[model samples]
Target: MTLTKSLLLGTSGALLAVAGAQAADLPSRKAAPVEYVRVCDAYGAGFYWIPGTDTCLKIGGRVRIDTWYTPAKSAVQLRSTGGPAYTGVPGGGTASSTYTSANGIDQLGWYARGLLMMDARTQSGWGTVQTVVTLRLAAQTGLAQAGQLSSVPLAVAGTTGATIEAAYIRFAGFTAGQAASNFTFLPSNQYHSIWSPSFPSGIRQFAYTATFGGGISATVALENMGDLAAATTANSLGFNPYSATAATATAVAPQRLPALVGNVRIDQPWGAAMVSAVVLQNNANFATPGIQAVTNGLGPLVRKTGWAVSAGLRINLPMLATGDSIQAWVSYGVGALNYTAIPNLNANTATTANYTGGFLRGDRDMTIYCVGVGCASYGVEQAAALNIAGVFTHYWTPSLRSNLVGSYIRLTPGSTTRNTDWTNGGLSSATGWSVQTNLIWSPVRNFDIGIELSYARLQQSLTGLNGAAPTAVPCTAAAPMCNASISPSNWTGRMRVERTF
Candidate 1:
């Protein structure tokens, strides 16, 4: 029995040894390792590292819907444009930068927009190389996106538009492609109000930004002004050049040279301060009558350089609430009012065409009296303008916030005595002011519902023979009060729902 047991044990041990050796020689089938996505904390949130690469990418989008209502400022309904004398005037006459009391124009409107954005960054020898692209798809109805200076509502109703709102590359402090103009000093977040300029998609340009130690920096850019807004629009010349009115700008040459823009800025814990300047070439259209020429004189269509300067300050008010702040901006322009946020520029006709033209009743860069060069004392004199704006913001809670904003505009139509006379057919001096308040509730991150209220007044003078607002629509030959002036001082309200990812 002992012998048999020993034999069995020895055999079992031999068999186990052989099996172990065979298993060791066989190929192994282990689970493959996972390539987990890594979070990139170097940049802000919502960034992740691409597998097998050092680059970081972020993808996001925004959708917004807005409904708005605005009333005409003047209670008196004026005569229509087809009248015997008021031929070139806006029919029923337009009013504020947002809307006018024009016939067949909508006092209420709505729009929806979607934006898709992608940002990619990679560490580089110069710092971080980044590229960003944003696409905007939008639809408007019932006179949405109207910012005419005149009372005539634009024809953008029932329009759908698409554009690359942003497409830029940054490397070694150099920026290329379409981006925000460096000439702006005030922050853009306060745009959801009647006082501020319309939300801008940025200008097409090449720029460079230099950072000094301690949040100080400077930037310079060259922008394609001709294509910036509808600057090329016929007869529409704004003092902010592109913000110009159509009535005065019959002949405007394309902007051959890109606008030169520069700014100096400082940012600190308390707040920020900045100063910006721009230079643009204003070329006269050869086809324009003498009144639209750079010089009504016999000289060939000449070129005049227009310029603008702006300053802004922002102060943090942490004592009141988290994210509370106050900001102020002032801009002065000589033929470059487009640099100033005054007429609520309408770069895209499909979107909003508010800045100037007959649409803008009170503001103008060139005061054109008639078609001939022998029009007035100064057929084409550069206009000067000033724009002032201030904004205040407070957070009632983590989810609730409000903003108060106001703006004032003044335009000096240089030497338009004969040019702006009712008989001569032109616009004269103008002034405007507006106040806006917005309350927003953000129950969660990336989503918000807000409402904005606005009260504004725009006063323009056609200078009755005595120099003041006229009394009649077309200053009839007998009464000769000058085409009537409508100072639309009215209220506007807007509600919006927006989601961002």
Candidate 2:
């Protein structure tokens, strides 16, 4: 009986132990902590992570607010400037009606600006693939206005889709989509001067790029064609040509094709160098409303084509650290320019000369160059723009840096002239230059504050103004209207603050 009882006790104990083990092995469900990546800078950092793959993701953005001060009378005069006669109302003028000034302080303003960028990449069995998207966001009231008591919204800032500044996909050694053009681009370099004044804007294009290792690459792009001068609303080469006609007819722009551009870049241990060319197609004789014409004509005449070629070099003085370097670039164009202002004037005569070096004579067609492409206005004419820019930068530390920049543009008018029933007009050769110096200090991580001082001089003459100044001849006995060929020059200064997340 004792033996049987012991056996039963042992069996019961063993069963109990097995039951405990089973209970402990039961699965328990719980949520895992979420993982994210973050960036911190004045330009704002991005957040990104792959959900199911090994690919890494990065996201970033920026917000900016700015204030400016200028002399009351220093603004550009709308009604008159020696370049083009104000046939309509006028454009930007003196700071009197446009800005607020108090206690010698010209004006104060703010802008809620932001940029968002996402980069995704993965290592695949075949090769590495990457995709990128960048955009800018801002409140309509972010931009300041001279006429309004407060600020007003800018229609163009966010009216488009998703603040798309750049979008592209890359595989192996090739990239395709919308991004910065290879032409006229400076690589692997950053300085205060690079961002001040007019920074190089991105463009939309279908491009192919080949990397040769060691910072050397070859690139080609087919991009949308337009003039830089059309930065203002409704002033682009794509505007309706009929709208420009004093008499209405049809609405047609100069070209319907894209531009072709290619570039080659080489980076050596000592410095970097790059060269590029672009070609554009132009229909010189198409007429459209609200469009400025290079010349006046009733029907479709000769086709126009334009082109641009540029090169640049940047060398690192071995003594100076990576932050300290010097760079320079030169660009020349011979056709439809991205930034030519169609002078507002009456082309009603056979030959119109501003009497400055500028002239718009009709038998010879006017040609504007764009990205190496050409757009012409029916006759044999040419316009050229030569630009030179240089900058030197010194980084006191990773968070602080200062730079000096100088740029010049020389525009030479060829045989371009416009004729109409009443008047004729054209542009004379002119030169403009700009110089800027700035100091950028980032007191905190992901935040930057800076002060900038810049000066610019733009000079233009009526076509006939190239010769000696016209004698002050009297137009009437009582009212002697002396034709003025000299346009006044302008200067500007700006201060800015930027934050990023």
Candidate 3:
């Protein structure tokens, strides 16, 4: 019995030892260390340090919805002409002669947009280096593309569009890539008002800003003018009698030089002020000077240069109320009408050359005319323009504010190069003005709702002053031809809601 007990004890001890040895040979279970994201306060709010790097990054975006209404007169004209159509009576007759009931007069429109932006910054030996990229997706309803003749659906329901608003880089006082120019100051009054001055929207360019102590800086840049002169000439003279001459004279000319832009700016406790200027080249080449028998032998035209200047001032009126301010600016251009904020003068669109005022009675930087047999010389008229805008803002409460804005623009074409009937009668001057007011409420951080009302008026030069002929339709006592000098005025109202982060 003693021998058996000893053997049993030895067997149990052997079993326990074998189990411990197996457990010791098994792999250990331990988790890897975590590298959590860290907040970065070095570069303002909303920035976080990238994992395992010193670079700071921020992501933000805005979503906006807008609804608006415009007068039937304006809407019909826009539908027929494809954009902001000239309001004066046509040479043949009144609105009845030019537009039909199918134009959908007095329409309401809505637009929704989503904007996304990413910013990355790092401190370098030279200075703080930064890169910014912004993208936009939009959907629209009830707004027709410029030049849609039929009542085709103008609304886009879903995210049917995308565009790059800005993509730029900055390092050591130098900015390169597509971005706003230094020439613009207080670019807009209310949200998306067309009456504001030409603010030189984002363009591909390189610029340098030099800081002078005391909140003063100067910038110089080279910007693409994008054949501005040729475009303006085409818009003024691309119809009927002048189409042939305009086509031959304003052929797409190669861009020889970029526009030179410069600005001086100062910021202070009171407000800010800036003076800006630009020089652009007006280059063109005639395609076939005397191709048609009627053109005679004129083939090539001379190249010209254009310039513009602007001055702006902003004054903080906190004494009146918190967030209160006033801003004013004026611009003058010679051969650069677009810089003066004239409608339909942008060079980016094919129909940009079309005028918002009526035909043969509006001004352009240049004009071309050919008439009668053996017309050798094409008219090349230099033009000048002026634009001014002012905005005043008042804060009723910490979360509520209102703005009043007004703008005026005038374009004067130079005297006819040729004393012919076509030159005299075909080209004239124009004046336009607009006023807008809006109230905006901010219910919470990064969110806003607003309402705006606006009015616009345009006046064209009278017919027959430049040897132009009167309308074919005779004047009636109720609406004399003389009254045709005024285009129909437009009134618009808008409501908007926006959220940002």
Candidate 4:
């Protein structure tokens, strides 16, 4: 028994040693060190630390769909786009005068937009350095927005486009690149900007902001406001007055200075307030005969400057709801009507979506008229504008809310007749008002659905005829513009669905 047991134990030990050595010879595999993306709460939600870097980065986007309805024969619609801006007839400016169903106008408009945003931030000795880039792709059919001409006929089937909505860098006390103009206070609670009197132009600028503790700050910026879709023009920077069918085309002086913008602002837990001012050079050369002043020895006309002032206030009403507030703003401009959110004749751009703005057909920075074609006797007059816009937001519940937005704008065309271009009649002052209301539902944090109703109207002060007249002021049956005293307006409704992450 002893001999058998001893042999068995020795054999077992020998086999185990051999197996252990073989196992050790095989390759070893340790679990890979997982590189999990670390969350960066320092910059708010959706931000994470880029691998092996101190910078925090966030990438997100939104998808939005919009559908709107405008009644037929709405005066708010531009006539050229198949909407009745001028009261010549119903279904005016259609592709076929009486060819398409005889006399019917399109009533439905739709738009879809996809957007992408990227933000990166890092801490440095000077301060936090940040950069943001945003891009958008959009398509539209029909129309309901403001200042837009690409309606049923112009955009017939549909139109597609892409744009770099914003790209900017900020560090220490400086901001650079394309961003919202410093002179404006866009209402945060408003949905349809058509009812708001906020300058919608995105401007190329270099700005410096100085902080004086306690959430108070001052900013000054140099912006190229004149660099519109078109570079320069005779009137509102590059914008023209729609009423100036016959006004002489004053030669535009090349830009000598960029627009100057300055603002003082205070932000606190309860609310925010700001006061802003801007100055721009009027580059129009005023002489009697078209561009004759620049060519026919009239010498260069003295360039006048335009200016605007704005003030805005916001008050939080947390006592009513978690996110409720009221915001109001007012602006006054002399020969700088763009500040009042009025549409310019210049082609609209992403920065300044003037196409969606309220219309003021006659007011202009410098109205130029010649005694006759090629005549050297010309004159100039400065127009003025005043606007007030406001919004009220109330949160009925955590997931339900509503917004009311309204705006009023007044224009003074000055004491001159701009009948040199279209030979309409004496251009008089006008006023416009817009009101909109919306209700939104947010079932989820990053998703929203809303419906809005809007109405806008324009009134003319045919003062030259001593009253308001829908018919012609100086009516001449042979003239195309003989009936020029009509006011335009429209009512529209929209539904929006949006998701962001």
Candidate 3, residues 1-501, lDDT tens digits: the string is: 999999999999999999999989999888977878889999999999998787999999999888776534311121111112333333211233332221433256667889999999999899999998988877766532322111222233433577776788999999897777566676543653544334323666789999999999999998766623223333223222433333244434446778788999999999999999988766544333356344552345546677889999999999999889999989888876655554322211111112122233332344444444343444455567788889999999999999998888776766542222222234346667778889999999879999988776766544442355533544454333332223546567788899999
Q: Which 10-residue window in model 4 sums to the lowest lDDT?
A: 93-102
TM-score against native, each model: 0.78, 0.66, 0.77, 0.77
Error of 1 at 341 (Å): 3.4
Rank by lDDT, highest first. 1, 4, 3, 2
The weakest ten consecutive residues by lDDT in model 3 span: 74-83
TM-score, cand. 3 vs. native: 0.77
**How does model 4 score by TM-score?**
0.77
- Residue 488 C-alpha lDDT in model 4: 50
Candidate 2 differs from the real structure by a C-alpha RMSD in angstroms, to one decimal, of 10.2
Q: Is candidate 1 or candidate 2 better by TM-score?
A: 1
Q: In order, what lDDT does every prediction score?
A: 0.61, 0.47, 0.59, 0.60
Q: In model 4, which regions exceed 4 Å deviation?
A: 1-34, 74-105, 144-155, 195-201, 227-232, 235-247, 250-253, 285-302, 343-364, 371-374, 418-426, 463-485
* Tens digits of lDDT, candidate 4, 289-312: 244435772334546678889999
Candidate 2: global Cα-lDDT?
0.47
User: In model 2, what lDDT does residue 131 have?
Assistant: 88
| Distance from true location, Cα of 164 in model 1, Å | 1.7
